[model samples]
Structures are given as structure tokens and as C-alpha cells.
Target: MKHQATPYFTFNGNAGEALDYYKQIFHGEVINLQTFGEADFETPEEMDQRVMHAQFKKDALFFMVSDSFTDQNVKTGSNIALVLECESTDEIQTYYDRLKNDGNVLMELQDTFWGATYAKVKDPYGITWDLNYTKEQ
Candidate 1:
């Protein structure tokens, strides 16, 4: 199975601004940018313009960023996480189980609205990981 890790940044707001700045500096292409307003479910009017997810790639490196949910707390120093993109469901479960052994499982593995199996875990060393497995198109 393939495993790729990308840096994920959580922003209280201004994710789009940050992505734009990074793109300017890194000269990368924005692969995807989705706003909360475009989601299938309903979102507050104020949050409609907030970024739900975004990704950019520069050479061999990929970066992701998103605005935090209204109910969530996101701080600057601790706002970064490692996102693991797994190739298969088995890889997702295996990594989740192993990493969550003595760590905190913030979000249990489940199907997401974006059609992916996803989970969030804080490993024993206090590093957070977001695991995801997307089915082939």
C-alpha cells in the first residue's frame, strides 16, 4: 500500500489568504480548493466563505490547509498536523489502530461526506495525524 504524508494547517480563518501567500512564495499550483459553502450540508452564512479544504503542490511537496470548524479551537503553534493519505482501507485501519494504541483518537475512523474513510489521532509523542483513504475514481 502507498502512504504519503502532507503537512496540514488549520486556520481559524484566512485559509485562502494563507494559501495564496504560500503559492506566491513556493510558486506551486493549487490542486484543490473547496469552501464550506460548497458542501452538501448546510453551513452558516458567515462561514460560507471560509475554506473547507485546499491543497497545493510544489515539486515533490504537497501542502494542505483549511479553516477550522466554528465549534473547534485552533491555535497557531499547534495548528499543524501530518495528514496521511493511504492507498487502501486496510492501510487506514492498520495505521489508525497502531497509532491510537496509547494516543487519543479525536475522530474515529468513519466515512466522510467527501467519500473517504478518515480519522484523526494524536500519537503518543503529542503529534497529531489525519489519516485518509480515498477510493479510486
Candidate 2:
């Protein structure tokens, strides 16, 4: 299966500003910008304006950014993660199994409201990973 890695940045609560800053600096298009309030998922009232997810794309350079959930805190050293987009369910499972072998499972691999099989894990070396496989319609 084809696998692609994208850098994901997590901010405490200034994801929108970060996204805007990156767009301005890179002259890239910020697409798929969604706020916690915009999504159908449940969130605290205070998190309504927080960025749930957003992407910045300029030519071949692409990455994602989002605000941490209300219950979580984002610190500088642990704010970045690698998003592995897999091509199939098995592919995701395979990688998840390998990565979580001696790692911590931040989020168990499961189906998400956004129509994808997703999970988050921190490898033994402390590098976080976001594994996802979007099912076909």
C-alpha cells in the first residue's frame, strides 16, 4: 500500500493563527480548515473556535495543524507528530502493530467520525505518530 508521511503540528489554542502565519510565509493554500464548532463532533463551548484540523499545501510541501483538545495540553517538545496516511485497512493495522510494539498508544486504532481508521501512538523513541486510513465511499 502507498504510504505518505505528513508533519502535524499541535498547538495549545492558537492553531488558526499558526496556520495563517504559515500560509503567509509559504504562500500556500490553506484548505480543509475546520473548527471544533464546525465539526459535528462534541466539544466544549470554549473550544468552539479552536481549530480541529487544517492543511497547508504549497507545491509538494504539505502539512497539517490543529489545536489540542480541551482536555489536553500542548508543550513545545511534544507538539509535533508524523501523520502516516495508509492506503488500506490492513496497511494501517500493520504499521500500528509495529509502532505500538514497544510504544504507548495515545489513541487506539479505531474508526473515526471523519470517516477514517485512525490512531495515535508514541514510539519507543518518543516520536508520536498519527496513523490513518480513509475508507472509500
Candidate 3:
């Protein structure tokens, strides 16, 4: 199975601005972007316009970013995470199970609105991992 890792940035806010800046610098295409207002989750009116998720792609490289929810604790240095994009469900499940040992599961593996089996975990060493497996289109 194929797997790739990409950097994920969590911003207190202004993720759209950050993504726009990166798009200019990297000259990449905005693959997908979704705001909290567009999601099924209930968000504060003030944060409804904030970016819930965004993806940028330049050639074979990909990057992602999102604005942190108001209730979430987000610090600058600790806001970065590694995202593993797996090619198969088994691949994602395997990694998730292995990494979750002695680690905290921030979000259990489940189907996401973006059409992927996804999960978030903080490894023993304190590094966060975002695991995702998107079905073949």
C-alpha cells in the first residue's frame, strides 16, 4: 500500500490567510477548502467564517491547514502535525493501532464528511499524527 506524509498546521485563526500566503509562495492549486459554517458541526457565529480545512497541492507535494476551534488549546510551536495519507483502509488502521499504543487517541478512527477513514492521535513522544485513507476515485 502507498502512504505519504504531509505537514498539517493548526492556526488559532486566519488559516485562510496563511493558506493564501503559502499558495502564492508555492504557486500551488487549492485542492479543497471548507469553512466551519459549511460543516455539519455547530460553530460560534464569530468562527463560522474561519477555515475548518484546506488543502494545497503543487506537483506531487501537498499541505494542509485548519483553524482551531475556540474551545481547543492551540499553541504555536505545538500546532504542527504529521498527516499520513494511506492508500487503503487496512493501511490506516494498522498505523493507527500501532501508534495508539500508550498514546492518546484524540479522535477515533471513523468515516469523515470529506470521504475518508480518519483519526488523530498523539504519540508517546508528544507528536500528533493524523491518519487518513481515502477510497480510490
Candidate 4:
């Protein structure tokens, strides 16, 4: 199974601005910018304009970013999460089982509107992980 770990940054409500700033600084382009309002699932009215997800790419360098949806604001030290792009369902399940053993399951593994199996977990070490496995279409 293939595994790619990418840095995912979370902003309180300024993810769009942050993405734009990064794009300018790194001379990258923001690809696939999807806002909460654009998602197939329902979102809070306040989150309608917030970024649900976006990718910044400059050649080989890439990262993901989104605005937080929780009641808590994004803290300085806890705004980053590691995203693991799994190649298969088995791969994601195995990782999820292992990671959640001594960790907190922030979001359980389940099919998403984006056509992928996704989950979020915070390990004992306090590092958050976002695991996603998209089926080939």
C-alpha cells in the first residue's frame, strides 16, 4: 500500500487568506479550493464561507489547509495535522486501528461525500492525523 504524509494546516477562519499568502510566498498555486458552502454535506451558516479544504502546490512541494469547524479556535501549537493518503481500504484500516489504540479518535473512519474513507485521530503524543483513502474512479 502506498502512503504519503502531508502537512495539514488549520486556521480559525482565515484559511483562504492563509492559502493566498502561502501561494504568494512560495510562488505556488492553490488547487481545488473547496469551501464549506460548496460541500455536499450541510455546514453551519458561519462556516459557509470558510475553507473546507485546499491544496497549495509549487512543483513537488505541497500541503493542505482548511478552516477549523470546532467551537475552539485554532491554537498556535495545535493548528497542524499530518494527513496520510492511503492507497487502499485495508491500508487505512490498519493504520487507524494502530493509531487509535492509545490515541483519541477525533473522527471515525467512514465514507465521505468526497468519495473517500476518512478519519482523524490524535495520537498519544498529541499529534493529530488525518487519514484518507480515495477509491479510484
Q: Best candidate per TM-score, number?
A: 4
Encode model 1's per-residue lDDT on 96-129: one tens digit a residue: 9998899999999999889899999999887999
lDDT by residue for model 2 (4-95), tens: 68999999999998888888999999999999998887888999999999999999999999999957778898999999889999889999
Task: Return the TM-score for each candidate structure.
Answer: 0.90, 0.94, 0.87, 0.96
lDDT of all predictions: 0.89, 0.91, 0.88, 0.93
RMSD of 3: 1.9
The alpha-carbon deviation from the true structure for residue 124 of candidate 3, after best TM-score superposition, in angstroms, is 0.8
Q: Is candidate 2 or candidate 3 better by TM-score?
A: 2
Q: Rank the candidates by TM-score, best first.
A: 4, 2, 1, 3
Residue 79 error, candidate 4, Å = 0.6
The 10-residue segment with the lowest total lDDT in model 3: 1-10
The per-prediction CA RMSD against the true structure, in angstroms, equals 1.6, 1.3, 1.9, 1.0
The parts of candidate 1 lying over 4 Å away from their true place are: 1-3, 71-73
By summed lDDT, which 10 consecutive residues of candidate 1 come out lowest?
A: 1-10
Q: After superposing candidate 3, which stretches have Cα over 4 Å from the reference? A: none
Candidate 4 Cα errors over 4 Å, as ranges: 1-3
Best by lDDT: 4
| Residue-by-residue lDDT tens digits, candidate 3, 17-119 | 8888888999998767989999986788988889998888999888899999776778888999999888888889999999888899999999987788999
